[model samples]
Target: MTHPDTRRPSSLTAKLAGLACLLTLAPLQANDRLGPINITAAREAPAIAPAMPETVITREEIERSQARSITDLLAGRAGLTVSNEGGPGKLSSVSIWGQSANRTAVFLDGVRIGSVSAGQSYLEHIPLEQIERIEIVRGPRSGQWGADAGGGVIQIFTREGTEDGSHLSGGIGAGSRSQREADAHIGARQGAFDYSLGVAHRETDGFDACENGGPYTPPCYADEPDNDGYQRDSLQLQAGYRFGEGGHVRVHVLAASAEVEYDGPTNNSEIEQRTIGLSASTGRIGFWQLRTRAGRHIDDQDYFRDRHFDSRFDTQRDTLSLANDFFLGPSTTLTLGADQTDDKLSSTTDYVEDARRNRGLFAQINTRLGERLDVQAALRRDFNEQFGTANTGSLDLAYRLDDAWTLTAGHGTSFNVPSFNLLYYPPYCIVPGLCFATANPDLEPERTRTSRAGVTWTRGPWAIEATAFRSSADDLISSPPPSYVPENVSEATIRGAELAAGWTTDKWSARTSLTYLSTESEATGEPLPKQPRWSGRLTVDRQLGAFSLGTTLRGRSGSENDNQGYVVADLRGSYRVAPDWRIEARVDNVFDRDYEVVDGFYQAPRGVFVSLRYGR
Candidate 1:
């Protein structure tokens, strides 16, 4: 049986059509008793399927990987690139399809979380242990998700309650560079009510993030050699109750507070990220099923140097969403949704504008042309208080050629509004002698047009997927050179190809993936900065009774502005002592390769860690 993203169909013909198209998929049930009805986390069926090229990382996989950070797990995955200024908890960014992080949208438990001033989500502060699942949708998505979706979307679902019982789980660990961590989760479900709560704390004394540099040279532009340290405390809660046979209501909250030390004029930062939302879903309203949510997200950050506060930025986003799904015909379903976001910003520096509102209305259709062909289409209209009206659309098609082969193609359009800092932050220098960045009020919104095609083959124990894609970006934004002023720089084209394969069995499992990316500035005919051309990863695992072992190797080629390429490997093992107890250990950067993910910074040399976990 297949468990889809959206609500199940009410008609037998629609159900049959859905079953035919999903025979090759694995099951991911949102709600067992309610039948695939998820109000808060469901984007669409195609976004989670091969139609749009998605990847799902589950809790089980998270535990097996033994990854210290979310970026470590996400990097080297298909169509993704990650950069870090130094070790963990410093400055980090993830790009999709060679685009900037601001072009990608992120959602945590259905709450869109990000910094309005920086125009990107602070994914570093989120506790990795609290995440239950992640859905990565690649390519442009503004036709379905509205602004700030020029690249794609990533949805993170925090741990939820176990059905019909009470459970407790926790773990503690210590690692290299004096790293330490502890986390606990307690959950229960009784009658119609269910809730899960988690809390985590992590701290580390990191290596020197940057080498001492001359005043006129790079590598942080300062002489600081002390060990940098980082700390974070986080909490998450999810609660829900079923009212009627098909009516459910839920609430979720996530909060994190962190302090990060780096090498710069403003060398330390205090950050806070919090989000809360309430959602309700009803099984039937006449011929339709309905879901609605209201939420508030906050990103607050403060910069400090030597215990003195330097600057502050506080932002708030208020959001409301409504979606209705109905059957249009025997093999077709239509989904219509409305969204509204109000963003307000407060900062130490002055801005020309403090707040803006965005409103969007969209409609999507999923239909089967025949027994072997399926199609999805979407159209959206958005109106912004500052940027005015915009329209976007997308189309995706999938055809089943035989029992083991499938062909897919898609086209999408997306747009991103200029950020508050991009539009109006005044020019200033934190270190007196040098200015970092400036803003332009005349900046225009960025737009992207993307096209992709792919093929998939699957059998009993083997699966493979390959795709080629191209994206044309208009009015791209950049901050270059001496002034570092933000502007609509130039139009660009990004082209790439990706392939992934996996094989599984009872005793052994192996998986591998590779990506080739190319980006060019139409004006200068040169490659963009900081984008790697080739990246790939290989993973091998083995099982022997209660003990398991695995190894992962990741490598990426050099690029326009990147240093010489590097290869890194991780070794991990775990032993199940009892039915509910386990011990795990990992050695990161086993080769101790000294390389920089970004210019003027250093990555971790080598590290070892061990953890003890107890759970149900």
Candidate 2:
């Protein structure tokens, strides 16, 4: 790979040197406590004590980090890997705990959001400006949901009205590569009604997305030296009304449209995604709490080799769910739920089957035994039109050693239905050059079982969490040798460990995480692609009067791409000039480390950005 200029500032040393002087500083007391809450770990309750290992990124963290997209916001978490083709507004994929990208399910406000044909969400297009918080469960919870959650679950919460009062906030930013961004948010709570609205726009004249430099070059690079650019616009709205004591009804709608330039026959592509959901919950009736929701989502894509046209694919899904929670006692609860989803796909290419439906029933029981032990058992059965039926279950146990320590363990089973393209791709051939690729119509669902154990310690201003997990899969899907046709042929095993620690005191706060993973196919004994052997991250921040400064460093071992490891650092600073006005600046890729997450594709070099904001 080549670049315009490799020369860059020593950002790594500068960031470290700047933080070295604040080692003994105090914490920012005005900021809320860093322990974020999780809403996706259980089905019966909206909020519960943490019995499973999870990670949460709050709005404050999102704002402080100055993330541009979902991919940037969740780059280096434990037991996870995010691979982008090049830079912003490009294709991106996320693999959790060594599972395939499709095995990880994504949701927005409890509604499943993704493509029926591809079986995954386009994370790069989700604007961060509308996000309130993100909840990531490190392990599977298939019994609570259904298919496509074989690896883990990620739930994104959009901005909601604040209890403090009505407020309006907006920001504008500019950065390297002719990058520009603008966003506005308005939220308020009045009487029994609450509402929030947000809009965002971002664009960038990005670097060359290819590594080969130009069309004449060999190996892997773009066919042209022209810079690939990207643009996106997003809108989000949420409103709710409360009645009775604890009865409430809510509705959420979000839409995003993006156009990105790339180096291929398809010189440019456009994507439009939209989601609308309605949910209602009743107050405690006797001993049961009832909730029901209905949602619809659409994923549409149009590709252009040039200004003319090339192809298009569109997917739509409708989901309905009803759940009830029965409180048996102060220490026991029973949860029952039913879910249904109908998916339809439309594409330029013909498919044998373009639509499918799924129905599921699930139950769970959670109990706290005495003062130390907590147990949860859940079971689910799903019936699909393509594949007959599947049963998945899970067991979770937790023991509190004392006020500062807790031990937990869990075992679960999960499965994924074959995607539309994997099972129904039609045969086609061009005149002079003949070509054919067959799909496996009889493909079976992939199944996995995972067991994990962990311990957590929290005391004073320090917290630590560690977990070890092992997963085995049957009927693994992959392209067979010469034919390169999809097949469920191999058995696989994956093992990993994740550790996270944090400390805060007065004016200083720091957090760090380390992850180790290994994966193998029992048939070939070769390591899985894109699963890094190790990764680590460190972040430290200091508060001084109305000014705050932070530094982040991340390192990861080479997986399938580059043969060596790489490290990147970033520095951020913000100052509040008035009660509702602030200015912030950030420098990313401080060291200008040249590396690649996708094989033969280079990453971004050093870049700087500045922004000004009003209100939050």
Candidate 3:
């Protein structure tokens, strides 16, 4: 089926030039130092130790960068390899330490937020207008989070209303590929209650499609549609209330819907998705703290092939979790938690409908040995009706060498269960009833063991960190011959190193990171496919009175499978047009470098956008 073209036009290059001119005419100012929040610390203590290899992107940085999505915001972090399977709102994935994208966990306000259908998170669905800040913790976190925590975690915190007053803000912008967006936010505080609401709408035309494995020569998919893009709408609301002395409670609700169209070799495909969630939490009672949360997630997909061949799939998940934190002594803290999940799937195909239930319990302890040393240990047991029971654990130690340096080490174990789609996808063949793919009910869960050592230093206005890590996985899942069964011959060993540095002075600030990774299949001794050996980024920001300017350079090395490397540049600036009004603009892909993260997918071309914001 063919759909009408409705994408807006992109103007990224023009806006970028305008911002550069504005910067030359204005004087720049210095940036201020914002104190860091130690996320790894369980409780307040003297001499808070930093979480090594962690990256923080503050509100100021977010505004200065003019990022449209979470993927754009995290593009520069060390040890992260991001790729989009299809352009824009399609499917995007990130790999850390040469691990698969499914190995990483994504959290919103400390709650896991990934789909059970593909075992992947859609970073683009997160509206940037609602974000307060993002915290990235690199390396294994199985002790803290469960399951897919082997590749690290990304936690997103939404904005909370301030106690001082109420405010309203809104903005509109347009960019390349006929992209347009509008966002608004309102926040207020009354008595003991504070609340915030946010909404955003985004639409884009996207780039032309190119057929896979065909000649790169012109006149190929050239006649195909140019600007076949996507649209998304999202809404978020949060409220918190503080009790007189020792209690506080909060509630959050979020909803989003999206529609996308793509060009294929013989036909075009359209996709739509909707998500809704609600959660509540409370705090404080003597030396004990209690928290509970329940949420539901749903996803539906429809694929239109020929008139006679269409497929649809629906997946839903329900989760309930509880946790308690208690102080055992002056030097030790203990945390206990339990979780239960129910997943249901329905498909239009002849595949069997299935329901999977999982229950887990975990405990963690944090202890301080002395003024200069700290240690943490945790254990978890998970029982899934389909896969039986699995156990995981982690141990971490941190030592302070001096006021400016710290040394840290950690070891963790994690696992991944096969998704329903992977185990039940039916086989099909060129012939009417011939078969090509079959299901295997005896598949085993993949297990991984990870270890890392790192060091960090903070001196003057400069901060630097370096880490090295190794991981091995057993019972690794892969697609093998005849019956498409999950085989045990897919084990892999991966090792990598990452380094990052940041410097901030009065009017100027800069940050950069470099990562190198190597992976090999233990069974066949061949390098893993799709992972690049090197990736790095450099960003610089400068502020001048009413005008601010920023630039970024991102680079990726050639992959092990004949993929070429590319470097892209971005420019952004904002001007205070009035006391309550500001104008912002950005240009991305300055050189329009042709690059692809996946084998056949094409990346977006150079784009530009200008926006205006008003607030009280």
Candidate 4:
């Protein structure tokens, strides 16, 4: 079921492959006008340049795409892949550099949010409407994020009040499959305090997500053809107070609940997520600046089958962190931080352990030379009640090749412990007293080491970047066929190349990306399953007065499952009717390409959506 590379490239070829990127980077030069500020790489620093490869999805881009969810917006990006089982609000996951979704850590307003029991984040539960911006850092980031960052990090920031005057905004929309949605938001800032609140609700009667039944094919459902439906409600509130000098305190609360109907005995499921965080940053005390934060996250889910209640899983996490940044010299800074978190789970199924705690400390240093060079290094150690201890580190470097070109490279290590379900789930018998299997409490943490190098050229309204990356992980936990017992593999390696280009003109703008990936398992000499070898995207948008028109083409060369290439196109148009009124519409899957992201699960069919907005 897995695809493996038969021929492995030499190490010299790998190094040369990265170096060859320099030649394709047209006029090697650097430009800073279009660089966006990012904070996820270092946690507390606003840096235009980080040693890692990263991307930012701004509010403007979000609005331009008119995307329905976070997964829709992120699916075609470089170094990323998304897989969905059913339709909207169903189980969805994001994979980075060919790694599993659970290996990637997700955060909201700098606070980690997910289920500790499953070791995975529910991307479908997150509302795209409440987000102000999103930062994605690709590669191992556990040195700064503590743990579960073997693949990468995704940080979503909520909308905030930025002006002194109060304003109200809202929208209503209708789409294919009887989908309807409405949302409202209000915000204001006065003196040292500012606050914003928003709420949204959406529901839809979706399409049949499974294939029809036949002699050769399995039944979609035991009874009849059914449409999987979904509904969601979300609320968000954030407040901040600025005091003396550069000191401020902020609080954030976000909650969302969803109910999704799917095929199978368990016809439907419900999920709820809530996160609350409080953080404060103090003015510089001499050469040191201090900050502290405390947060809590709750994840609850329930299942229903054949009109009967099945089970429930509820998990809670509490976290606290403190950090300090010291100005070491004119061009140097050092950061030290400590973090603690406790995870507790309540479930219908009994397990040996239902609670676990982790504590960690980390340090980083950033320095720059007279010109043309910058460096950052970070290290961290974590102690877990169930897994003993682990350590991770990263180093990144950037060199200015010329006025318009910059060369960057980075190396990092990360580790993730097994989920509680894999570790201590009760043994199950297959035939009463015939066969049985027990959970593996002795499972070890998965360890990964990754490296990347690239050449970036930025000038005027044009920017081009290309990078090559390789990641290898040891102790990859998997449950093979037949016995399906969890065990660790010797190693798994992933190699890929990513290219992105952007251009802007007075009336039109365009962006394009291409990715090539290969994965191999050392133990089996086979490639990992379900990872596409090639993917690409092209987006073009035109602006005319109050009218905007855009189109996006996404193509994926399917992997082991489909083994075929498919392309889907989307079209969007928006018109500002008045100063405070606007109308928008989008048609996704314009070509209606029949594609399957997961075997036996059909992708969303062609759909049209229209919306009206006011006071934005």
At residue 52, give the lDDT of candidate 4: 52
| Higher-scoring candidate on TM-score, 1 or 3 | 1
lDDT: worst 10-residue window of model 1: 1-10
Each candidate: what lDDT? 0.77, 0.78, 0.67, 0.78
Query: Compared with the true structure, what per-residue lDDT tens digits does model 2 show for residues 1-616?
Result: 2110000011010112122222221111112222433568776364353467677777888887777778766766777787777788777877789887788998988889987877777688888999998877867789888888878998888999976579999999999999999999999999999999999999999988766445443223236666888999999999999998578999999999999887654568888999999999997788888999999999988877676687788899999999988889988878899999999999887888889999999998888889898888889999997788999998888899998888999999999988887788754232224434656788889999999998877778787777899999999876544465777857989999887777777788787766778888788786666677776667788999899999877666776423545677889999999999999999999988886666655678899999999888
* C-alpha positional error of residue 250 in candidate 1 after TM-score superposition, expressed in Å: 0.8
TM-score of each predicted structure versus truth: 0.91, 0.92, 0.87, 0.91
Report how far residue 247 has shifted in candidate 1, in Å: 2.8
Candidate 4 TM-score, C-alpha based? 0.91
Candidate 3: tens digits of C-alpha lDDT, residues 1-616: 1111111111111011111211110011111111464453331112233354566667667777888877777763687888664476755667678877777877676556665655656676677787877766667776566677778777777777874689998899898888899999999999888998989899898775443333222112223445557788888788888774345677776666776655532233434333334444345456677766666656665654332335666667677777787767787778888988788777666546478888989888877787878787878999889788989988878788998888989888998887654566565332355434544556778899999998877778777777889999987765443344545546899898877677878787877767777888888686665566766777888989989899887766656542466667888898999999999999988888776555445677788999998873
Model 3 CA lDDT for position 129: 81
1 or 4, which is superior by lDDT?
4
> How many clashes would you count in candidate 3?
13
lDDT of 3: 0.67
lDDT of model number 4: 0.78
- Model 2 scores worst on lDDT over the 10 consecutive residues at 4-13
TM-score of model 3 (CA atoms):
0.87
Runs in model 4 deviating more than 4 A are 1-34, 46-51, 212-224, 426-439, 561-564
Residue 439's lDDT in candidate 4 = 57
